[model samples]
Target: METIIVENIYKYYPAATKKERNKALNGISFTVKNGEIFGLIGPDGAGKTSLFHILTTLLLADGGRATVDGFDVVKDYKQIRKRVGYMPGRFSLYQDLTVEENLQFFATAFETTVEKNLDLIHEIYIQLEPFKKRRAGKLSGGMKQKLALCCALIHKPSVLFLDEPTTGVDPVSRKEFWQMLKSLQLQGITTIVSTPYMDEANLCDRIGLLQNGSLLGIDTPENLTRNFGKPLFALKAEQMYPLLLHMRAYDQTATCYGFGDYHHITFIDPHIQQADIRSYLQGVGFTEPVEIRQIAPGIEDCFMDLLNH
Candidate 1:
């Protein structure tokens, strides 16, 4: 079953004096299968949040249509809200309220007490229970994150939509959070997550790469990297900064993007061998220069290549 189906969805924000609205989603269309972890991978201002708002029934798209769990997002918003659990990209829980208060409020709003959904959120809720008396605003980034999620799950939703849920979370919390998600999936709840982190893309069953309100491609992490169809090499030297400048000078350097610890390069000319580049680096007295070898492309590499293509 398709848990979410969006077709040619277009959302625009019109300037008050202008004749046309700025487009947020450019006729985007995709379907997420039931019981699968689907991802909307993109950077900030990439229309990811806009699309999430549309599907979660918070905003209206100027054109096009979307349905969640067989209910039209526009026409069946009431039902959709009831069946879906949404955690917005930004922290939106009651700031002044204690952790327990926030959870109690949402539980009462849904007319289902926390005890009613205890089985649904036990694993995550227990972690938050320790800080139940703490003000939501006073909690750490990750604890607040867990509380927000617990509230969302109190209703035992059929589908979960999390927008950048781990954005400011600590590494330990992020790992713990993903584990909670995996546990939720075991209960048959479909999960849709949106993130700007390329590393997180691999955790999903499939990911749609979005940029500037456009989806560049959709595939599993391994498949996306495997089909990159370009040779990539990693180069390192004592004078790393200067080495990149020299490498870029070569006409054969198709793409050269820094990857923190090292820089990745792509060859436009197949005839330019790795050994030739190695010898050139040596001639510049680049020390042992470590090593340069053909390397497998990762999610980030594929994303960059897709943008260029």
Candidate 2:
């Protein structure tokens, strides 16, 4: 079952000058399956939040159509709102309200009570129980995240939309949050989450790589990496920036981008060996102990590859 369907959705915003419009979403189309975790992976300004607002019926698209839980995003927004849970990119919960008060507020807004959906949020709520009396603004980043999630799930929504749920969260909290998502899948709740962190792509069942308001590709994380057909290598030297420039200027270099301690490069000619790269750098007066090795492409690598093309 397709829990959510988005077809040729378009959204535009006014630019600095009144004569021009910025395209926030450009013909975005995809289907999220029932009980599937679909991730929108990209950097900021990729229109993740814009798309989220459209699906959650908080913002209307300029063109195209979308349906959440079989309700049209524009026309049947009221029905959609009742069946779907949405956690915006920012913390939108009442700051002055205590954690318990915030949860109850959302539940009441949805015409439901926390007690009725206690089982849905039990795993997450327990973590926030000790701080239940604390004001939302006074809690830690992780605690605020938990409280927001609990409130979102208070109504036992059929589909959950989380926009950048793990951004600014601690490493441990990010791990714990993903675990909670996986647990939600067991209960047959569909999730659509967006994040700028490429590493989080692996946590989803399938991911759509979005960039500059367009989707580059959609596939399972494993398949996306497996399909990176070019020969890729990681090169490291004492002088990082200089090495990156040299690699980009190489005749056979298809793509070169810095990846933390090393610069990842893909060869235009697959036959080019790792030894060839080392030799070229050395020939260019790069006397530093250069290290070059063929390495498997990751989600970030795939995303960069897509961006390059």
lDDT of 2 by residue, 1-309 (tens): 999999999999989888878999999999999999999999899999999999988899999999898899988999998999989889999999999899999999999898999999999999999999999999999888888889889999999999999998778889999999999999999999999888899999999999988999999999999999877888898989988888888898888899999889888788887678778887888778888888999999999889988
Q: With candidate 2 superimposed using the best TM-score fit, by how many Å does residue 104's alpha carbon deviate from the native?
A: 1.0
Off by over 4 Å in 1: 15-21, 279-290
Best prediction by TM-score: 2
Q: What is the lDDT, from 0 to 100, of the residue 275 in candidate 1?
A: 78
lDDT value for candidate 1?
Answer: 0.88
Q: Using alpha carbons, what is the TM-score of model 2?
A: 0.96
Local distance difference test scores for all models? 0.88, 0.92
Q: Write the per-residue lDDT of candidate 1 for residues 1-309, one digit (tens) a residue.
A: 899999999877865668766778988999999999999999888899999999999999988999999999999999999999999988999999999999899999888998889999899888888888999999988888888899889898988999999996777878888899899989999999998888889889999999877889988888999998878999876777888887787666888988777789998776678777877666666556566878899999999998897
Question: Model 2 misses residue 111 by how many Å?
Answer: 1.3
